[model samples]
Target: MVSLAPYVLKRPWLTKMLTPAANWYASASGYRQLGLRYDDLLEEENEAVQIALKRLSAKEAYERVYRIRRSVQCSYTHKLLPKDQWTKPEEDVPYLRSILAQVEAELAEKDALDSMTVIKKH
Candidate 1:
């Protein structure tokens, strides 16, 4: 659970310095051109991701699958989405990351509670 985001965010200078480079990296990664959100690239084999996907609204789930399938089709055909169809930076939100964070937090809380010892004085 050691995330560098908090550390980077805490330093405004660092955030300012890295924002453009991060955006450039994201754009260069080409998922956007394939009409895929950053979250769509996340590994689906993990329990946390599975729980997160399950928590998504039906529409969101359907859209996620559509994006993945479309991206796969694009890969098969060796084509990128049309320029107009590329995912806009504004539209590329961390939908799954927030839910995954919540699920992980709940799991951690459960683990903590499960390991707790109770003592009673009569």
Candidate 2:
């Protein structure tokens, strides 16, 4: 709930100052080299993430599975994907983020409704 992300993102100067460092960290993380997007590395044990995964389009779901499988294969072999096959910076998008956000929002709404305290002001 408490994060500096929104504050930094809202300020153009702060975002500009951090963009290069963020990019550098992403590049250094090696998931791109394994052909996996940042979202692909998310923990599936989460309830909201499970809901989000179920909501993915069939094509997107297939690609997600393929990427995970390929990354697992690479891990087993102790090798990265070929340079050409490595995920480009532009291709490393957060495909699951929006869906996950939606799912989390819905869950939060459900919890609020379930715990509602209706006051009778007779």
Candidate 3:
């Protein structure tokens, strides 16, 4: 599956571009009152996720554990997508099937647009 997380992190400005439309409060959650910049938000989220991992107490079980927060960039991001939103992937956990479905749908759309170059060469 193609993950959008890396793309967003590489282009940090995308966060700024997305923020004007975001209803920031809900996005900030516990760190809401810090008055942090978008970059700072990454740090705050990383800390929270680290704490959660510690709570699990299984950090040593994995050679590497990385927690990445993707999706729901803003307070406006509410309401989970309906299961029917996705067509379903063959190898996907029932819990994660919706995510795979959404990503697959997006990849399909991008592929189609790229295929239609609209050119005629002699």
At residue 91, candidate 1 shows an lDDT of 100
Provide the overall lDDT of each model, using Cα atoms, as 2-decimal numbers.
Answer: 0.95, 0.95, 0.40
Predictions ranked by TM-score, top down? 2, 1, 3
Q: Write the per-residue lDDT of candidate 1 for residues 38-102, one digit (tens) a residue.
A: 99999999888899999999999999999999999999999999999999999999889999999
Off by over 4 Å in 3: 1-93, 119-122
Candidate 1, overall lDDT?
0.95
lDDT (tens digit, per residue) of candidate 3 on 57-121 = 35521311221221233224643334443222222113223433465566678889988877688
| Error of model 3, residue 22, in angstroms | 43
Q: For model 2, what is the alpha-carbon lDDT of residue 94?
A: 84
Candidate that would win on TM-score = 2
Candidate 2 has its poorest 10 consecutive residues by lDDT at 86-95
Could you tell me the TM-score of candidate 3?
0.23
TM per model? 0.88, 0.91, 0.23
Q: Which ten residues in a row have the lowest lDDT in candidate 3?
A: 61-70
